[model samples]
Target chain A: MVHKALKIARVMLSVYYAYMVEYRAELVFWVLSGTFPLILMGLWVEAAQGDRFDLTPTELVQYFLAVFLVRQFTVVWVIWEFEREVVEGRLSSYLLQPVDPAWRHFFSHVSERFARLPFAFLLVGLFLLLYPYAAWLPRLDNLLLGLLATVLAFCLRFLMQYTFALAAFWIERASALEQFWFLPYTFLSGMVAPLALFPDAVRAAVLWTPFPYLIYFPASLLINRPDHVAQGFAAMVLWSALFWGLNRWLWRQGLRQYSGMGA
Target chain B: MERYLKVLRLFWGTAIAAELEYRLNFIITALISLGGLVGSLFGLFLFYRTGYQFAGWSWEEALLVLGLFTVLQGFSTTLLIPNLNKIVTQVQQGTLDFVLLKPISSQFWLSTRVISPWGLPDVLFGLVMIGYSGDRLGLTWADYGLALLPLTFGAITLYSLWFMLGATSIWFVKIYNVTEVLRGLLEAGRFPIAAYPAAYRVFFTFVVPVAFLTTVPAQTMLHQGGRGWLLASGLLAIVLALLANRFWRFALRFYTSASS
Candidate 1:
């Protein structure tokens, strides 16, 4: 059964990859649309001129570049898709399928990464060429661990958003709820700034949340700071499991409610 | 002009009534807007904590720029974005034919058909923020009056840019993603244009005109610059509006109904 599922996943990945390629221009635009990190990078780089944040200007550039790369990997749009499907009664079709619908969404997102990789590499190359001073080579061990952490981060983010999307079963404003979640995520996940740059108390509180494991931990690893690698990985696994369980419970309840309405 | 105002009034009244039927949406929208405001403030707090001057603007001046950004965002999201997004779907499903067939001007009708009144809270919040920041900066009524001309021109410029983007959907139905690019670039407007690198400042000023959208108004209110930018903004708006009108006519010539 595991082998069969793996094979099915491969097939779905390839199919979705082809679909993404067909819409390659739109995909490029989507990728280019994540310029917020670069904007913050500019601000921080200028701020670093006074050498106040303990990070050199080059370090600030590297940190934000890492942020931009990790953000592309960990981003999830399942809430939007799932909300639309549930609200439009399209999930009923998915329910009739032999395979679980989550696998389909997972494969679609995974395939998007595959489609986006070449363009991402090109963009990174151009950026490095433009700013040679910002370039830094990470240790091999750090690079490998960062990759692993990024994969886990992606899974954790996808499952958490999917769990949130399950709210559509009861409320039409699930997307608004997602927006509410984004407010905290933006600050806590180190998207706005490095967690270290935040005040001590805020950083301490943010560290307790699962948000940092999604972006900050992986970004830190990529930049060769493996101080909390073990703890971060443990927290990531625990959060992913928690979200998975919650998603399963919500899915079952939502299915019951959905069918009760005769959808 | 009176006829157009009457038509807009009728359309907005019905749209508001239809939207109010979902009373919970107002609460949700208010919450989301509040969240956005808080998030931006938190970011400003972090930036200020590092030091006093951000790209040579004081904390209060920076806050004023953020307020301007919020106002423009609220206006665009409530009126321009939703209406423009509808063009994508209309073009895709051939519903645009109905829009074009109407006796009224299609561009005017398409742009004003829907209004998300729930977004008014963001507008009010932004105005209050501007007032508070302006008062902190010791801005007088004359300063605000000076800012008004440029602010109006900025709004026209933004509307023209968005209208041009929406008109492009007639040729490329999937151009909705271009709006995402516009939104991404708009994030830069949260800061003063001078905060960015010189190269980025040029790009935002000329290519996207984000500087006109937020920076100019804030500067005028702060009494930092003279009326030259205001006149430039008005001229740019007229030129862009004419160009957008031309493009809309050109795109209409290529419209093939999906039903056919």
Candidate 2:
């Protein structure tokens, strides 16, 4: 059974990767669109040059570079995809398929990430070349941990957004809800700034929430701050399980509701 | 001119009434707009907490720039983006033929066919922010008066840029990603252009010209940009409008009817 599932996953990944390559322009745009972190990096680096923040300019650069890298991995678009399918009645086709619809979304997103990886690497390489001052030597252990944390972070974000997308079952405005969720996520996820730069009260409050575990904790690992690694992993696992439960509940309810509506 | 006004009134009246049918969307959009405003302000607050001026602009000045950015963003969302999106879809679905068949200029009709009244809350919120920031700066009435000229030109420039992008759908049916690219670039306008590095400053000013969208207007209001800059902005708007119009015509020539 496990072997069959692995074979299916392999075929799905290859198919989606081939399909994703057709939109090379869009793939490039997606990579460029994720450069907001670099913009914030520029601002913080300039400020740090004035010795205002406790962070040195080089530290600010490394932190935001890590942020840019982590952001590329943690991106999610399943909310939009699910919303479109549900609204347009395309979900019916997926419902009839033998495989779960969510797996298709997962495979497609993973493949797109693979397609986007080279562009992201090229951009990062160019950025580092242009700003060599931003270079840093991360410890090998921390680097490995950062990669692990990043994988977990990506899974957490994707599942969370997929759960949010399930709201489409009840409302036509699920995307709006997604936007509402996005606002807080932007601040809490350390996309705007390192959570450490936030006031102590805000940082403490955010750490308790699952948002920081999605981006900040992983990013902090790369910067050699592993003090919270164990706790971060614990929060990640707890939140993932909770979201997984919520997703199953919502999917069952939504499917019933959808079929009742004659879809 | 009177005929265009009548047509616009009729178009907006029906469009708004059609949108009102989705009552829940109104509340959702209002909340989303509010969320966006709060998110931008929170970002500014974080920078302010650092207690250092960004690009020589204090927190108050930076807030004004953000307000102007929000106002222009609200305008684009309210009047421009939805219409452009509709045109792109029409082009894709071969429904643009009906638009071209209309007696009115297709450009004008396509540009004015939709107005999202639900976006008004963002405009109101942005105006309130601008007023508050202006009060803090103690701007004279004349400063506000001068700011209006550049703001009008900026709106024209942005509209032309969007129209040009929409027109390109004639050739590239899936130009939605280009629109997304523009949206991403516009995010930079939330801060003063000076806050960016020299390379980015040049790119945003001359290449994309997002600086005119917000930064110049805010600077003009604060008595920062001299009249020379204002004149240059006006010239750029006219030049861009003409260039966009020409590009639209050029694309139209290549547009073999999607239906056929």
Candidate 3:
């Protein structure tokens, strides 16, 4: 049974590999999307120059660079993909297979990350060599932990966003809701800046939210050993369980709706 | 001139009629737009809390920049973006043949195809913010009017550049990625150009030309920064438009209709 599941995962990976090859230009385009975060890093580093915050300028550089790395690895297309499949009735295609649809989707998500690894590695090396402060980056073990946390965070985010996307099956309009969910995540996820930079009240609010676990915690884990990696990972695991439950519930409900078993 | 006015009038009427058909959607979109404006203003407010001045500009001056950026962004949403954004799908699906077959200029048709009149609220909100900020900053009406002149030219330049980006779909089958790049570049407009370092300032002023779009307008109004920079931007716009027009023509030549 384990072997069969591994085979299924392999097949899913091959399919995504084929898709990526077929859309090679898109892969290049997606890599270029990393440029925006790098630009943000540039602006922040300049702002931090000769100015002391709680962290040094080099520390800020390491922080954002780590963010760029983790963000690329933790990316998922599940929200948009889930919406498209559900709306277009393509979920039926997935239902025909013996494997769980969510599992297949998650497998595809991981496969895409693997595909991005080449460019992601190249960017990391380039950033370290080219940027002013390469020495400030965390050690290799911390880097591995950062990678693990980021993977868990990606799974958590996927479950949450995919659950949100399943609302398309119920609502006539889900785009606004999807946008609402995403726009706040940009601020809250520490994509634009560290949650620490936020006002204390706002930072406190964000701590309980799932957003920080997505980008900030993993980033901080890699850049500097904050006093909170263990705590944040615990939070991420808890949220992951909750979101997984919510996703299972929603998927079951969505499937019933699809099967005309719901009012 | 009369023909152009007639086209504008016709497009305006159709847009209004289309908007009125789904008043609920219009209302929702308008409210969302207002929400977006508030979010943008709040972002500016956050930046202000950090310091009295950023990169040599006062907080109120920065507010003017935000207000002007909002206006330009509104203009895009209201006029150019909705219509042009669909160009890729239309081209890919072979529906652009209908557009090309029209008696009017294809550029004119595609550019003015869909104006989201509901987006006018953003314009109003932006103007209100600009007016209020100017009052608080003690800037006179003359400054605002003088600023408007260059900005008018800047707006046209920007619209033309964006249309050119959309027009590239005729050649490159997957120009959506290119459009995504532009969207990414638009984030650069969120902060004042001066706040950014020299590298970014040059890049925005020259490469992306966002400086011409937002900062120049705000600078003119708040600081009365001379027309020298504005004229240079205008000249750059003219060059870019001319090149874009040529590129458009080149792409048109490669267009074998995807239709059967």
Candidate 4:
């Protein structure tokens, strides 16, 4: 059974990887859009130069670049695709498949990370060239830990969004939920600023939420800060499991509620 | 001119009537905007909390820029996004033929076709923030009046650039995210131009003109930076507006449409 599952996973991954590569031109623009962190890096790096903050200018540059890389890997759009599927009743086609439809999204997102990686890394390289003084390699253990955390962050983000996508089963414009969810994720996730610079109370409060682990925790680990290592992983695992449970329950209930509206 | 105004009224009237059906979406978007406002405030506060101001900008001065940015955000949502984003869909679906066949200019119809009320909350909140901060800065009504010229120019400049980018869809076809790249870069406008490093200041000013969008108008409101920056912004808007029109006409020449 395990062997069969592994084979299926391999097939889905290869298929989605090809599909993602077919739109190579659009992929470039998508990569360019993630330059939000790089822009913030400009502001933060300058701010850090004053020595009022705990972080150095180089560290600020490093942190935001890591944020940029983490963002590219963890980006999830399952809600948008799933919303269209349910609204158009195209989900009926997926319902007939033997497998759970979630794997398709999971694999597609995973494969997209591969297709997106080259451009993302190229952008990182461009950023490094722009700020060569800030360029430094991560320690081996920290590199391993950061990569692992990034993959897990992607899963947690995907699960949370897909779980929210199931709301399309009940509501017509479920993406509105995502739009609302994104506001907090954009701010609380440390994409806007390092959690270190946040007010002590705000950072402590945000740490308990899933947002920081999605970008800040993994990014901080990558930058070799090494703070909150144990707690961050635990939070990510707990959130992932919670979302996974909620997602499965929603899928079953949605199937019953779904009437194949447009199909 | 009168005909265009009549058409715009009709376009927005029907658009609002249709969108009113999705009352829940308006509330959702408003809540989201409020949350965004709080988040933006929180972000700006982080820099100030450490007693670090963006060069010469105080908290209230910076708030003016943030407020103007929010207003432009609302303007885009209400007008720019609902209309310009559909350029890609039209190009993809070959519906541009119908648009071109219309009695009116295609760009006119395409740009003014939809108006969403969802952005009103952002506009409202933006004005409130402006007023709140304008009061804190002890600015008079005349000061607010002075900023309107640059603000209008800023909005025009933004619309022109966005339209020009959207017009590129005729060739690129799947250029939806191309416009998203513009939006992402415009996130720089959330803070004053002074907040960025000198290199960033030059890039935002010359490369993207994000500095014209928010900081120039904020400077006008504060009675700082004099009239030089304001004239440059107005001139930039006029130039971009004409270029967008020319580019749209140029792009239409290549519009072979889909499935041809």
Candidate 5:
């Protein structure tokens, strides 16, 4: 079992390195894409106007800066990867591999996020230095919970997105499907604005959905008050389990369809 | 002009036929798109409920901006998406050579290669929203025309900028995130430019051009300004388009295909 696991890990790691080498320039370009968030940060800061919002202007600044950092830390690019592989017949290469293709893809996906950390941290430090308020925003306990929540959030997001991609097995032109999934998540995932800032009904609705656990939970852990962290963490673990089970069921059904082609 | 129209007609016809092969997909996808539109509006509605106006513009104005944004996005997806998506393969595999050898302008042909007819739904929806907003905001026809002209110009500027970025794929070969960055930046336009305050208004208007892309155009529809600014922005788009064409030609020289 150890030998098999190590072999799979080694192969996926090599694929990750290969992807980095091939797309190094694209990686740099993506890192530059962080500029938009910074621009939004500046804009939102000025608009807040001396603690005009519920939080102080500095607090607003800290919120967006944390958002930028957490987003960079947790962003996933697998939806496109899965869609492309299926659409372009590239899944054949993965199918030939001895280990499960989804597992290999997940490892590589995690590696990409890991590889991006140095740059994400650099930006976080810059934000911290420029806006000292952000550095003091998170308590140690919440920070720890945030980190743990981020891991679960990543797993839940991966499961949900993988299921969405698996739907491509049965559908053609999956871009619309991908877009449909992404657009709502953009709002509910707390990428647009805080769920707390959302109307009470909207906030309740988002909380009930799995989307907030993807990004909002980690972001809220950092930005929200200390009292809110434990609740957010509990919510995350619950959603993670729900999505994981859903993903497992979908994968099993999808595999059945694949094997039944011969039957 | 007639030739261009004919080209558009033929391409759009082919695209619709191709897309219609999966007709249920159109309904499902459109329904999904409607869900997204509703979600966006839900966010906007929540913001409005808290206060009468955000920054300076009212809900009606914000909707207009969103409508313009959706229309431009539809235009890009319908016209440029299919073509620009192939840039990586064209460069990596050297299949761009086939495109270059074609009788028409390589840049034009390559840029307009595939059209997604379904994208028209977004454009239609955008027009409807703009009309509804104009009526609610008490905008006159002259004001609407003024706004439409600049928005048309802004849309062209957006297309030109995308063309330049897409052309960069000839050299970089893997800048898929370029479009994503554009999309992300454009998302800021969902709210009024005033919502962001002064520096952001400047950033959106001058630097990233997001204001011209949506907010300013939407504002013009509400009679925020006469046609002068819109005309100037339109002229700016023409110049940008010229520059993009020049860059496209320059990038072509660097296109050593992976396939070759």
Candidate 6:
């Protein structure tokens, strides 16, 4: 049984990777669209040139670069995909499969990261090339931890969005919820500015939410700003487990609701 | 011109009626715009709370720029997004053939086909912000009037650029994300151009022309940078508008109507 499941996962990932590779041009555009962090990097780096901010210019550059990478890795579009599946009655086809429909999206997103890896790295490389001084290799343990946190971040974000997507079982425009959710994620997630720059109260409040671990925490880890590393991982795990439970319950309830509609 | 006006009325009338079915979406979008506005203020506050200003811009002046940016963003949501984003879909599905067969110009038809009223909340909030900030700055009617001239031109420039990018879908069928890139870059306009580094200022001014979108209008409003910037913005708008029309025609030449 274990061997069969592993084979299934392999085939799913390979197939999705091939499909994603076919859209190399679109992937490139997507990578470019994620350049919001780089844009903010310019402003923050400029501000850091002064004496007001907590981080120096180089540290700000590295932090935002790490943000750009974390953003690329944890980008989730499963909400949109899942909404479409539920809306167009396409979920019926997936319901016929033995494996959960969620895994298909999971594998597809995972494979897209790999397919998009080169373009993302190329952008980072170009940025570093333009400003060679901003480049710095992360310590080995920090790099490893950052990678692990990034993976966890992806899983957490995916689970959260997928749970929201399950609302499409009842609502026609469930993606609107994700849109509303994204505002807080964009502002509080430390994508716009580092938590270090945020006022003490705001940073303290934001750390309790799962937003920071999604982008800021992993990014901080990459830049060797390891503050409360254990707590950060704990919050991520706690949020993931909570979302995972809620997601499964919703899946069951949404399945019943979906079939009730004669879909 | 009369026929075009009539067609636009009909287009938007139905678009509004159809959209009204989802009345809840209005509240949702308004809440979103409100949340986004607060978040933007927070970001600006983060910069200013440290006693750092964007070079020459005072808090009120930067607020003026941000308000203009918000208005332009509303404009995009109301018109540019709903219409232009469908270009790729039309190309991919071969619906462009039908659009071409219409009695009106395809560019005009495609550009004015749909209007989403959900962006009104943003427009309202932006105007409120501008009024509040301008009041604080003790601006006269002439200042607001001068800003309007450039603001209209800025809208025209933005529409032209967006239309041209959408037109590229005739060649690359699934390139709607190219417009996403444009929107991403437009986020830079939320801050004054002077706030960025020298390279960013040049790039936003020349490469993407984001400088014309909000900064130029705000400058004209504040009576800063003289009328030279406003004149340049108008010239850029006229040229880009013409280029967008010509580019649409050029792109249409490559339309092979794959599905057809």
> How accurate locally, in lDDT, is each candidate?
0.86, 0.86, 0.75, 0.93, 0.73, 0.93
Candidate 4: residue A59 Cα off by (Å) = 0.3
TM-score of 1: 0.97
Tell me which residue pairs clash in candidate 4.
none
Runs in model 5 lying further than 4 Å from the true structure: A2-11, A32-43, A50-52, A83-98, A125-137, A172-178, A259-263, B1-5, B226-228
TM-score of chain B of each: 0.96, 0.96, 0.92, 0.98, 0.91, 0.99
Q: After superposition, how far is residue B170 of candidate 2 from its true place, in Å?
A: 2.3
State which candidate, 3 or 6, has the greater TM-score: 6
lDDT of 1 by residue, A7-118 (tens): 9988999999999899998888888888788888888887778778877788778888888898888778989998888877888888888999998999999999989888
Query: Across residues B79-155, which tens digit of lDDT does each residue of candidate 4 receive?
Result: 99999999999999999999999999999999999999999999999999999999999999999999999999999
Compared to the true structure, candidate 4 yields what TM-score? 0.99
Residue A144 in model 2: lDDT = 95
On residues A1-263, what C-alpha lDDT tens digit does candidate 4 reach at each position? 99999999999999999999999999999999887898889889888888999999999999999999999999999999999999999999998998889899999999988999899988889888988998988999999999999999998999999999999999998998998899999999999899989989988898888999999989998999977799889999999999989989988998999999999
* All candidates: TM-score of chain A: 0.96, 0.96, 0.91, 0.98, 0.84, 0.98
DockQ order, best first, reads 4, 6, 1, 2, 5, 3
Query: Mind giving the per-residue lDDT tens digits that candidate 6 earns over A32-55?
Result: 999889889989888878878889
Per-residue CA lDDT of model 5 for A117-198, tens digit only, reads 7777777787778777556657787788777777877777777777777876666555666677777776677665666667
Task: Please give the range of 10 consecutive residues that has the lowest summed lDDT in model 5 chain B.
Answer: B46-55
Q: Score the docking of each candidate (DockQ).
A: 0.75, 0.65, 0.42, 0.84, 0.45, 0.84
Q: Give the runs in model 6 whose Cα sits over 4 Å from its true position.
A: A260-263
Better of 3 and 5 by DockQ: 5
- Residues A212-251, model 2: lDDT tens digits: 8888888889988675788899999999999999999999
- The reply for model 1, stretches above 4 Å from the true place, is A260-263
Any runs in candidate 4 off by more than 4 Å, and if so which?
none
